[model samples]
Target chain A: MNLAQPIYARVKDHILAQIRSGALVAGSRVPSENELVSQFSISRMTANRALRELTADGFLSRVPGVGTFVREATPRTSLIELRNIADEIASRGHHYSSRIEDLREMMATPNLIDDFELRATTPLYHIAIVHEENGMPVQFEDRYVNPFCAPNFLKQDFSHQTPTAYLLSLLPAEELEHNVEAILPDANQQRRLKISSSEPCLSLHRRTWSGGHVVTSATLIYPASRYALYSRTSLGKQTS
Target chain B: MNLAQPIYARVKDHILAQIRSGALVAGSRVPSENELVSQFSISRMTANRALRELTADGFLSRVPGVGTFVREATPRTSLIELRNIADEIASRGHHYSSRIEDLREMMATPNLIDDFELRATTPLYHIAIVHEENGMPVQFEDRYVNPFCAPNFLKQDFSHQTPTAYLLSLLPAEELEHNVEAILPDANQQRRLKISSSEPCLSLHRRTWSGGHVVTSATLIYPASRYALYSRTSLGKQTS
Candidate 1:
């Protein structure tokens, strides 16, 4: 009856609302394509499309010749090791958003020069981004780049393309060095992530090397309570 | 000279003391073998063996033409990815210690039977251990095992060796499942780890599979501030 929204969206939302609100539990059969078509006065194709998309997005699982059932809500988590954060979130069928908090060119500091082995006078590009999933901020990324490694670094709209994606699109890193640490968040981090001050944070520091040069050094901070890196796939090198 | 300690240990202690105390900084060359042989009135082989052991232990880097120099103090961290914790710490030249908190044979709970897909009323082996490094506690391990998988599970002395080492010795896992989470320390965990209650802990859960069965499920928890997982080695898949 809501004419403002499209018919397909309205139908999808009506079914999704039931699933999310626990009206339809996992393994419970969803409305059949015919039932949906007749109940909503929608075409058969529209009902099929809604179910198909829902299955693709992991909301439902369809058994051939049988009916579709609500699925368990545990999303397959991202492979967080040196992965592009945007692509990782998108793969799980979640909305991905980024806020470019700071981006500018600055002279390489002593620590950068020492760690990155850059010349003292070499100018560097610094970028800070807050990445969110479904409107909740999860990670804060602070990255520094070597100008020679990525020229024209400052011109792009990061909202459209992430810095990591753009960098990989230009050239994949030959080597990645990663270090993970746990720390208590400061006041500013608490505000940015909207987490409690007592929250512990997992800080992942990564160095990307390309063409025998340190291309970029990034520090990604995540509220430990909100997110974690997980893996379950096997390498297939089995014993026994 | 202290008569109680052996000569080689004295020589090693002297050199190590300087390096650890920052009396000799990184890249600073140590006294030559001949000079050590004369200064301590020791044999040529004693000096050579001490230097060689130091190089092997990562305290010094020896160049063929140049003399041995104090190395950077950053120890190559243990590969924490389902690695044998004892070997990992040994590889980093640190003392590894484990306290067996609890080990017993018990009936599998409903949750364990559900998560592990075991038959109800099956007996399970439960183990709790606190792993320490350099006299500091770092990780607390809680584990459950299917007795049919490792029939002699209760006989091993975990103090001399780790439970992981024993399980892996019997049969290498065909599949491994890992999940990581962050949580504030509970009173029990804080007491076991000797960490403040406010500290956040990184909890890694692992399931090891063999012969299409989950042999062991382990929950390893570490105080975030004290230890971290680090890697600087390359995978060697080149780009650019």
Candidate 2:
């Protein structure tokens, strides 16, 4: 701890470091001001100021009656740019993992064929995976890849590499289309995401194109309670 | 309409033109296949192609046993950028209006003082507005302005110029921070937006800074059923 800063500033930094180190996680209770005061041998006012500043800065959320808790690092809104979940989690210095629910060859429906500009009933690769950050599920990714775009898509080891990373390695996408909606999750989605029926989800419908051919289509769903899509751009640029 | 393209292509262009011209609005039914066939003196296949392709391209949405409707022009996920709603509606050629619910000076609460970095009880401008696109409510903007930054904030006519527009004109923002969440709206928000309780909303919490001073903080809410946030950017650039 730096001796230059004020007592309250140092206390704020201490709590922030704990949050950054993952010793504190979202929804976990923080130490009460009395505890901080006792530990640091500081006045109660200093402890209160530290906690108040952190809450104001968004690192913590305080319920009036209940105690303060670590705020979930809200996921950046995926509306602006396509981001890989594994990368996002890793950037936060958290553990990243995925549960592969299904990966197999499937016949493209008429609608799928239209999307890929392929003939009817063509073979396509389908994959469904649940992405986790620090062992907690955060996103359920359901995806379909055109066989014509990547024939060996099913053979990739997705446990170590994300589908998004793998696909981008195959070819950097030239164009991308996105649709973001807040929806009530289906029972299956709810189960996979470990969310209740009352909880809505932010569902992102996305498609990527490479070399003038549709490469993949995906539906990524995040439980509203766990994540919030975020973006920052110049004004007048449409963003959710 | 250009005569060079195929008849069905022309029909598709016609509908698109109507949408662009604001003759057709979101949730409003599009001309049925039979109606298009009769109007254009074309075969049913051509009419069907036009509607089907439009649906596929996202300009329209179809429902069985009901009819096709003009899709809500999904706000481009300004993941890479922040976009103004008034500009978006104007670009679509739709009539844009705002109902100012509240615009007055108010004392900053403890939390507001922290957010604005002001002394407690400092006068701040607060505004509550419902923005409409083609006479349909789309966004409810609840904003608080730092009077220290814009002293004449309340003097501006918000109807002719949006708060965003007004603020932006005062000074180009140096930085913007955004948090986007899908939430179940409160009863007051539900009534103002004219949406059902079951419907979720995309809520955006945004703050802007200019010249190293906090300019504004706002909560913008959009009904999930009526609006979908969208964005398109290069791969790997994180967006909401």
RMSD of 1: 20.6
lDDT of 2 by residue, B65-153 (tens): 79999987755545434467898788677789999999999998888887776655788899999999889999999999998788999
Q: Considering summed lDDT, which 10 consecutive residues are worst modelled in model 1 chain A?
A: A73-82
DockQ of 2: 0.19
What C-alpha lDDT values do all the predictions have? 0.78, 0.81
Give TM-scores of the second chain, every candidate: 0.68, 0.69
Model 2 chain A weakest 10-residue run by lDDT:
A231-240
